[model samples]
Target: MAQIVGIGLLVLLLAFFTVFTYYAPHGDKAMGALAAAAIATFLVEALQSFVIGDIFSLGFFQEAGTEAGLLSGVIVAFLVALTMGVNPLNAAIIAVSCGGIGLIPGFFAAYLISFVVKYMERKIPNGLDFIVVVIVIVPITRLIGLLLTPLVDASLLNIGNIIVVATEASPILMGLLLGGIITVVGTSPLSSMALTALLGLTGIPMAVGSLAAFGSAFINSTLFHKLKIGNMKSVLSVAVEPLSKADVVSANPIPIYVTNFVGGGLSGIVIAYSGLVNDAPGTATPTAGLLVLFGYNPAAQVIIYAVIVAVISGVVGYIGSHFFRNYPVRNTDFD
Candidate 1:
């Protein structure tokens, strides 16, 4: 009964979050900030602490990366507020208030508080607004973050537990589902990085997500070129970062999505078979995800799996392009 209720609540919360992202003002930007924060913090840690520090035995890089990871909530809140057009100083204050919380909770606090801060900016008059924000708004925002922290953490933890159990039960199947869906999200406005962070994905699930995303870069580039959906620059950009060519992908969803799903699923199977683990959440990005894999697994093993996934993804893209060769596509510009 409790499990059913938990599932129901998770669905409801996800639905609300989805609607908020679509309908709320600057919602997409706020979520984009989440991805940016993850890159700035977690990705840095993956590269610095894991790769540089652990591999090279350097204390400085390790300490710096660890510190950066600790500031995840601060960075997230700050960026979210700034993306919502809050004053820089005020954003810093909101970020500080959200200190000691996790990423998702910090985002919620900052996102909700940004509106109040905006309202006060209008009502409190120009010079006085900063004072009011520091005095009244800061503490309130912090309080909200503190209150939401446990709830958000608990919810994400539950979801993570479910994923862990599923992975244990059947890793290959979970890999297929997560890899495909997350790669699709990687190509969408909703960002795979943000989704993985929200779910607090770790272990094999994170491995699947990370590698699947890396493999998608090849898949997208190959598919775009073969299908003649965009120019050379756009195709290259999609390979580096699919979101850069989101309009093109969105415009030609049938071919792009199908190819990504197929390629990412194959890559997921490869990852699952290898049993590679990625402990870092939100590293479900291409370059960073690949680098982070080195942090967790044997370098040679990681390389072999990555190469296999990339090659398979490229082939999938090639085949998909041929299959959709005659299908009507909207060739888009880089601009």
Candidate 2:
């Protein structure tokens, strides 16, 4: 129940951002489109973890049925982003991409465009980065997809087999793993790719981890500004980019270790207290941790408890990093 509701809230927030970016009339159309598209692509990527196994994944369909991936709608949206770069078009493309990989034709299409864009831009008076989507980005995506095809296929079959079994004893433990530790670890320098795996194993904790990871950093930076802790105060005031130089330290295992030790600990305690349960089999990392908290819809009361813990973790993460982090602040007058 908490998982479902949290996802719902996240989706709504994304929708809001998409709409706001789309409706604005300005030079930022490409950026807006990119934002919308990035989120959408992630959403589509998530289907594999949350919905049908690899057998039903877009990559699976593309590998088995044809060389193609993505729906007609996705292709059209991609084209739209190319031509207009409007928020509406990009947002749609993003939504569809995230909805399913079958709808994304991989990056081969992008690869094709890279050359065309580069040549035309050089040949003509003005150049455009618009082609990077298909060329550099999409081609890489396709290559990775092709490479991962076998693993994807085998894993899906395996997941289908194990899900029922995992439902019994896996979720809570997995949830704790994810909520407590993976959250911090995933955000560190080791690998964000790990986060994708975490999300798949258990959508719930991963989702919390997602918002908590970024926002908690913001909150921490904000708090320092409130106090008189040098220029981190000022830099964090704007989220033009969502991190600080402390990212170097923050990326270390120590920070994540400290974070998950407590974050997921809280999540685990709550899982036990609520008695709500998980019914899914999953991979390792955070989502695997979610296995403990499935099936049972956490009632309104339980949801509140989860929220409290999440909030507490976010605050803790912020404060912990804020004070403990050692990074130099940029001087405003240096430039």
lDDT of 1 by residue, 242-326 (tens): 6666545655677887788788887887788787999877777787779878878899999999999999998998999899999
User: How many pairs of residues collide in model 1?
Assistant: 0
C-alpha lDDT of all candidate models, in order: 0.77, 0.37
- Kindly report which residue pairs in candidate 1 clash with one another: none
CA error at residue 112 for candidate 1, angstroms: 2.0
Off by over 4 Å in 1: 1-18, 181-206, 220-262, 275-283, 292-300, 317-335
Q: Which 10 consecutive positions of candidate 2 have the poorest summed lDDT?
A: 237-246
- 237 Cα displacement, candidate 2 (Å): 11
Which runs in model 2 stand beyond 4 Å of their true positions? 1-36, 41-116, 123-173, 181-265, 277-299, 328-335
For model 2 the local lDDT of residue 294 reads 31
Which candidate has the top score in lDDT? 1
